[model samples]
Target: MAVTRWIAVAASVLSLGTLFVAPPDAPMKKTDAFLDAETTGVLGIEATECFDDPAYSRMANDRVVIYRPCEESADNQAFGFVYAPDGAFDRPAVAALGWDRCGAAFGKLWRGGSAEGLDFYPVLPTAETWADGDRALMCVVYRPGGKLPGSVLPLAN
Candidate 1:
């Protein structure tokens, strides 16, 4: 299947009866090093490879994103970083801000390509980290159903 078409199908399948509401405050885990070496100290860098949930083993919070080499086999890929707007660490509000930033970044990178099979989400800061002054939000893209063989980044000129 064409990459775009495949992405659409994968997104639809993954979204079937599934909701990704943020966990309640009581259950959310505190974390440090939300972005790994590969993801940190850089901005607008494309994923050189792909990653999955297992690659995120370093951090327990799903909102914390760590980059693993594609050769290592992982579920999601770090597309870029978005700094969270200054505010209280309200999960929904932060998420909305993150998504808006990510959307703009994605558009700049993808140039209006079909976002079907692709899933873009934010790795946000927990209240504890927020209080500790963690404001960097990791924006990632992945295929919900399986692995992506290579970087999903648009080819550079």
Candidate 2:
């Protein structure tokens, strides 16, 4: 789906689920780290450390992990999650589900009026990764031509 359309759908579904932002002291999951590493490799962005701003702690669901780069100059925030399906695994189906899930959650924050200028998109599991049983999807949020100052969670508050 187009980014704008997905955002619209996501805004409608924001209130559908409970949202949780990971506490600063919480341990980072290996999956979260893996997503971070993979994203760096895939996007070719140089990030030496995790973003640790107290105001912008990581966010997670039971399966998804959203992270950001530490560099104050970075342009976007990223979310990674395993997209396992109950039945046969189809690429399009998996992508759609992952996309919507990210959209809904992020949409919640955006609809709350906290995420005014940011945009988001998902990077889905490639065929090679899927063959190896990796179903991770990374959702990235960003503001065009700008840097984020803090967490969207708090902005909503």
Q: How many backbone clashes does candidate 1 have?
A: 9
Candidate 1 deviant stretches above 4 angstroms: 1-50, 54-67, 71-73, 112-116
Distance from true position, residue 70, model 1, in Å? 2.1
Summarize candidate 2's per-residue lDDT along 68-101 as a digit string, tens digits.
Answer: 5544544455544435665556767876776688
What TM-score would you give candidate 2 relative to the actual structure? 0.49
Clashes of each: 9, 0
Candidate 1 lDDT over residue span 67-87, tens digit each: 457666556677777777777
| Best TM-score among the predictions, by candidate number | 1
lDDT of 2 at 63: 33
Model 1: lDDT of residue 74: 55
Per-candidate TM equals 0.57, 0.49
- What does the lDDT read for residue 82 in candidate 2? 36
